[model samples]
Target: SSLTDKIKLQEEDKSENKKIKSFEELEKETRESSLKTLDDYFKFISELDRNDWFGVFVNAISSRFDPHTNYMAPDDKERFDVSISGKFEGIGARLQKKNDFTEITELISGGPAWRGKELEPGDVILKVAQGDGEPVDISGMRLDNVVKKIKGPKGTEVRLTVKKVDGTIKVISLIRDMVETEETYAKSSVVERNGVKYGIIYLPKFYIDFENKDSRDAGKDVAIEVERLKQQGVSGIIMDVRDNGGGSLKTAVDITGLFIEQGPVVQIKSAGTKKEVLYDRDAKVQWDGPLVVMVNNFSASASEILAAAIQDYKRGIVIGSKQTYGKGTVQNVIDLNQFVRGNTVGDLGALKTTTQKFYRINGGSTQLEGVASDVIMPDRYSHINIGERDLENAMPWSKIDAAPYDTWKKQDNFEKALQNSKSRMALNEHFQLIEKNAKWTKERKDAAVYSLKLDEFKKEQEKIEAESKTFKPITDYQNDLKFKPIPEDEVVMQKDESFKEKRERWFESLSKDIYVEEALNVLDDLQAKPVTKGEINLKKKGVKSK
Candidate 1:
């Protein structure tokens, strides 16, 4: 049987090196790699018989309505809660299947894997062993199975034999612990440049635990960070929401409140209802200074809401990609079991239904068009089609009457500031190289297929590798600004040396970031403008106001 063949190929000792020559050998090797841990499939399949297949059937039907809507079983709902909260019992590392290897994408801060200091991004996990048991070779195994093998009860140990990017292998033992998704939270850094303090807050997502009373929204965290930055006397703040896939609609509105005084944050149009304008009732502005919000094609929902609100109100200059991810529609999960009045045969799952669509205060829906950047910059995904329109069965965009909102008084010269940024970005060599790299990357992605012929393949790979070596200068770009982590995080950084090293590398990358540099330039231009525009405060917290 085919299963027997798969099992034989999968169970075979992968350590036995063989020089593959012909196409037939290559095909065999691929199958071996793809089916390396074949028993996992059988084990997983055998356990899935009890799952509610009807839920999947209904979900398929529901997906046709919109991509955001879905069906969730009880377990799925539980897992979804865990994902949103960023709290789960595991080794604490994000993994993705790449080139037939489950590679570590990112290590969570202060987690078990981070504490172990052995596992790292780009390390390919080859095998997983549970508490001194037989190490299960996970090479080419399904990601689902790999996760199952790795995730066990808290306090249990899981050993992973990982092949590093350098091609060396090492077995690392990590104890499973509760890794609270600290990465999802807001983190700030003070970048001092030319006697000016600029604050940068990186918000990975608009995360909040709706079910847990102890968990706070990301907006609260952002406010705290803003206060800290205010304490440091930052002239401007760069709220980076680059790849943030939005969450917590309430939190998005709350975060926008931090910059502007008060007004309509976002407009919602649910079925059979008038447009609902969510207002920030608090009239006090938290940060009455220049602000720049960073977003990309991956930024969606809550991210788009905040960016769009800031743009509509002319409160801050939106910078980065041409537009954000166009996901304006909202979905609410409903328990399917509630519909069954009588005792059902089994527990039915919940349905995540598209109940509403959000629009900007100025009336344009961010469904398909998203929010356009004020200072558009060249990014890796600028050319790629990765927005709401690109998604299957996405809703069409519509417009409504604009909500009443006042522009930030001090930003009367905002247009000139944008032009100044554009002029500078045009002359920057770093941005030019980035644009070139984006084109090159797209072309490479288009022609990624390799010739199965060994000689031809080897030559092509060599050519690519040689080309890669030429990018040294651009990759090595560094700025004079020294980025310092917030004082609160310093204690944790000191305890975990690896975390500090990771933070150091991140800071170094930020220094090289042309976008951030341009944003800083934009902030400077705003400050350089006429003082008569508005009554703005640019002084430090301790300084006496004139």
Candidate 2:
């Protein structure tokens, strides 16, 4: 059977395979199919014009200076702008290429595709047609070309022929509109454990709108979320920036101010210039209770700055991976068209290049050594080389004079909480398995050579699969904590089923997160005990009493 037919049969509802091919036969078939696909891909690439190749060449040259520096074409620049702003005029369905077919990975919430409820994730897009026009087959087409065909001006119709996961085929029509990427914004949820409520704020990026000041930005949105969480009577808050690849620098500083008293947050230095410290001058602390900033290996730039500042001031416990993504340098996207005058060469796109470097208030740069978590957690990527230090042309780590700041002294049990969390991690069965899996993954990565003989390959795969079964419980482990949205979100969820579904999925994931469970435990340990009137009187009299 063809790939499409096989996919239809295998993924159909209540379907089962009638026959199973041997491993060798299946492997041989896959190899031949993949080779033909590769041949087709190269053939398509061979027909590209000079302008397309020029764009690639320009980017290749720009990358030699640094990994972050790049030359974006006109279309690339448009996409970059949409990403930073978190909005775009399109059908709002994210697509990925699977072999020769275009697969819908996600439908932006509240957008046309999602609101229509016709298209869904895992549905294969077979054809696209512009408003009552002839349909064009998208098979074997470049992903970008397919995207171009689907996205159009607002209110315009785009008809897509899709193969549903249940082996059904249908044509869905959607009107393009301004779709907001809700996942890029900050959202909060409340979870209670042991009679105390905790707020979990997930900030995917420090987004900002340069063109419109009134538009929603990360700083404003997160501040609003913090206020909402406070209204829910949360005793502690967890700011989760895990996998956040960073965005606006100003938002990072603004967010840091929410937890701490007015103080220096980060430092910046350009070539041949003295260091300048960015401070959060606002004296109004939003939430003064126990805090935890969660981060992982993918947290970079703005995320690192937030974690580093929190760590420096002892305002919160940094928990998650050993260190972050280590991207301390800043980038500025310069419009290339500004350099040209009265030219007919069309759109020149832009250039994003390294500008300055950022440092923690304590003086150390997060360059090649990202902020170290106070309570390190074991993850599958723990043993992998995935930080700035592993990348070519990455900046080196350095230090400067520490900025003037005061450490948080209100939480006297900070050290105790840190020690308790570390001890818990050391004894956690799930974490132990994660550590073992990480080491095993590293070993497999290192030992890449394998026998080509079918029997030997089958035997090796069987042995590896048997060994991997030991770590299967990691995915099945659940902390069983229930998370609920704030009252405001609950109201919106009542009117929007899609919004409710998205929140439920997030809550389900949080319930299974052991790291979050541990963070809450640390928060529990950090809770201050109520002082008695006698102790207060003794303190007032300047008398030391037990």
Candidate 3:
């Protein structure tokens, strides 16, 4: 029976919507089973109008906004509950449709496909098969059905014929496994320059499983990694928290504990409730070394919390854009069946209502005023500004009593060193490139009208290109789509130096990104000061003469 029909029958039983009988009505409605075949499914789909189809899709995915949230339609929920979980598993890769073809956007890092080493981003999957027979072309197929066909039990093999970007085709086989979330653990690396090493820990996301209470969480994993990095003699560490959407709150505090000796990491303030201060255990310090956190506009939720705490306690330098996504509010998933009881309209889907607001240890809410960067850099989002501050229903920025903690002592000549670095960056080739791109982007964004007339549009585009050609190019001269904004490149190397065209030149130039180069330079300056009486001295710098 359709979900709507079930609700209709229940509503008729009690002429009023607020009054639903007892647990029996709820249990009986929830336990209702569906008996339908593949043909029946398609027949039902074919009968639906455009609006109905869209409504069905919306109803199917509505409850998945939260990590633990889910909405199971009758037909789909049956397969998940009755059957095995591993069958809906394959090489564990996230695929997406771009233009008209299915392309691999991200590899599961350590999954079967990643281990095969054949699949990569931008590779188009042309066909799939079970054995060494003819492959089936799955072009123009729906993404869900395509995934369903590819996924199966563990140890089972599947073959994929993929087409490279250069049009070359090859076949590769991979075994399936029930993908585990823990497999995406914290990864760490070290970068060394001029005898000073800085550990780079890239946390993809904060994750914790609710079912397995004993499993090692992200906080515990990060603590272990930090200890290992300290053992390797790293002078400092860069906690790169980019694109991390956030996970368990418990892990957030645990992760913060690694750096902070003891203090409140974050404060939770809600309506008509006592403020709660979540403190780090004063157990031991993993690495209280000089710290720098790298974040972008996409850095959100728990990412903002970690960055805010470090900033509040003056424990680290926050480096990135002007700010991050201001998502300070915390939400609680209230199962409608629990609170609303019998007064719900069908499965009004669990309400993910916002309950509490998170604040930095210093009492500043991270809502609108996302942790500001100490030093801002040129990013694509530099010019295009839009964040939580520019939202309609966004909460106001406020603060409470500040927490007491020793501020991370400013390194001698820190400001002078940063200014000198910025000066050098302004004169850098890559910085100029980004600046030009930003200006051009702003103009395009502010353009009043677009022309469809071929001649007029081409003429305008050519004019823009001619003006841009005067500036020195960054990296190399490539026929990228961005150049199409103007029309042509003028091959003008009148003032600046131009190098011979070599693939290695592009690779080597990008290998030392201007932003990363500046970051490394800062790290170098920071490493020169000797640890005397737990205080830094710039004059007695341990400079190595070549």
lDDT of 3 by residue, 132-196 (tens): 65455566554555577678888998888776432335667888876655335675656555546
lDDT of each: 0.77, 0.81, 0.61
**C-alpha RMSD between model 3 and the true structure:** 18.4
Model 2's alpha-carbon lDDT is 0.81
State the RMSD for candidate 1.
8.2
- Candidate of highest TM-score: 2
Write down the lDDT that model 1 would get. Answer: 0.77
* Positional deviation of residue 395's Cα in model 1 after best superposition, in angstroms: 1.5
For model 3 the TM-score comes to: 0.60
Count of clashing residue pairs in every prediction: 0, 0, 0
Higher-lDDT candidate of 1 and 2 = 2
Query: Residue 420 of model 3: what lDDT?
Result: 53
Write model 2 residue lDDT over 1-546, tens digit each, in one string: 233323443455364655655555555765676576567567778987876788879967987788789888888888887756567789877777666789885566557887786886557898788998856667888777889899889999999988764334577999999887776679999998656788999997888887899999999999999999999999999999987878899999999999898999999999889999999999999989999999998788899999999999999999999899999999999999998899699998889999999999999998989999999998876886767887677878999999989999999989988887777776666678788887886676456476866557656755765877777677676776799999999999999997898788788778877778878877777789632323211111111112
Candidate 3: regions farther than 4 A off: 1-183, 339-348, 390-392, 409-417, 446-448, 457-512, 528-546
Any runs in candidate 2 off by more than 4 Å, and if so which?
1-32, 87-180, 530-546
lDDT of 3 at 413: 48
Model 1 residue-pair collision total: 0
